[model samples]
Target: MSPIANAFSIDVEDWFQVSAFAPYIDRAHWHSLPCRVERNVDLLLGMLAEQEASATFFTLGWIAERYPMLVRRIVDAGHELASHGYEHHRASDQTPAEFRADLVKARDILEQTGGCPVIGYRAPSFSIGAGNLWAHDVLLETGHRYSSSVYPVVHDHYGMPDAPRFPWRTGDGLLEIPVTTVRWGGRNWPIGGGGYFRLLPYNVSAWGLRRVNAVDQRPAIVYFHPWEFDPEQPRVDSANAKTRFRHYLNLHRTEPRIRRLLREFRWQRVDQAFSDELEKACAS
Candidate 1:
């Protein structure tokens, strides 16, 4: 029952990005930003196809609307289609009503285009923290079977350090599969996702993930965006220096590291991984 033997996922978004950097860029300007989602995702799909791997693709509804064929390709290729919200907005920023509407909008677009039950969600920027815990209910009501929206590690913008490290039942019958991390000394150390995955050396991320899975027996849910592999994306203006660094750093190295990761571990779609784990638990 090893956890490292679990799933891989992709968060589909433009290279311009989200979270702390959202405020700096104008909403209108997002349209003017280069459209790389399809091309970059196709590259990822090619890699996954080469490896004969399937992963959960938590796609932005906006992207799905523009690239319905891409959504079709993901599902047709056997990848799980899931929501990453409609406009990449944080759940905490919206009222409960707004959040519900956003989730519904995204789910409808995803299910219609992908022609599959959209049962998984990962919030834009992992925004479902303590302040927005009620989002769990919205996800359940919207027909999402599981969510990977909680980071469960301290960050300036998002996290719930007290949340469970492994997948657990949240409100109602919904499953909360938090992004993976390791508790070292007193602080939570990121394994292989987001800025930590891009900024660190490949071996460091691999070792961290191995350590977490070996000790906890919980699958290390690693995530990345298609834009991470696109080194030539247009640079958006940012007032904050730290935000700029986080968004732009290590753009070139991402794909190589991902290629290495595919070679190193067994990767499957999120739901498939969950099902396998449940079967193993039952067998035990």
Candidate 2:
């Protein structure tokens, strides 16, 4: 099996995204909008099933309430169901109490609907950086076993550049799995995930993944949102130029590239891959 099999993740959100679009799309308007979460998720479920692969779905709680069937479908299909907070709010914007409450509400809803323990988390916008690293404790207290929230690279929005690249224990024993990147000449570059996977040439991304696996000999965690596949999604009228560009950039190519990725790498849910690695670690 390709080593990349061990760390694939899927973020379940609508086309109106969190980080870039939050400033443009007001929270109040979210409910009134036609729900696209299920439609996009169905697209992904079909793709993954065709490849006989599974992944962790970090679902937004708001979407779960509106489309509980989608959450159940994910569980029924043997994918891991996990929380992506009640709303797409940045962890840094929330105080610990607010973050804890938001997470608890999300976890309760996801666990009840999915009929599975929601043990994984990926913060909206990768917002759980050094400023809010203490949020890790809140996550453990709320029953999450691992998080894919930290982006260990310098970016305009979010990153903790010095954070460990692989899964490592946080202060509260929560396993923090930073997204995968390759280090070259002391510079770390994002590989096949999110916009990087979308905007960059496919061959360049493939080589980046291959390089990381070759040097680290560890499974590289890659992530993408379901909304990425919805090329013809209704456009929300908004004024923030940056948000519009980030959300709409390369939407047409995302799904085809993702299909190619599935063919190239063995992919599975993060929790399942982690469990397998843990067993191997013990054996050795």
lDDT of 1 at 96: 93
Per-residue error for 191 in candidate 1, Å, reads 0.6
Give the winner by TM-score.
2
Q: How does candidate 1 score on lDDT?
A: 0.84
**Which pairs of residues have clashing backbones in candidate 2?**
none
**Could you tell me the lDDT of residue 16 within candidate 2?**
67
Local distance difference test values of all predictions, in order: 0.84, 0.84
What is candidate 1's TM-score against the reference?
Answer: 0.93
The list of candidate 1 runs beyond 4 A from truth reads: 1-4, 276-284
TM-scores for all candidates? 0.93, 0.94
Per-residue alpha-carbon lDDT of model 1 for 47-124, expressed as tens digits? 999888889999989889989999999999999999999998888899999999999999999999999999899998
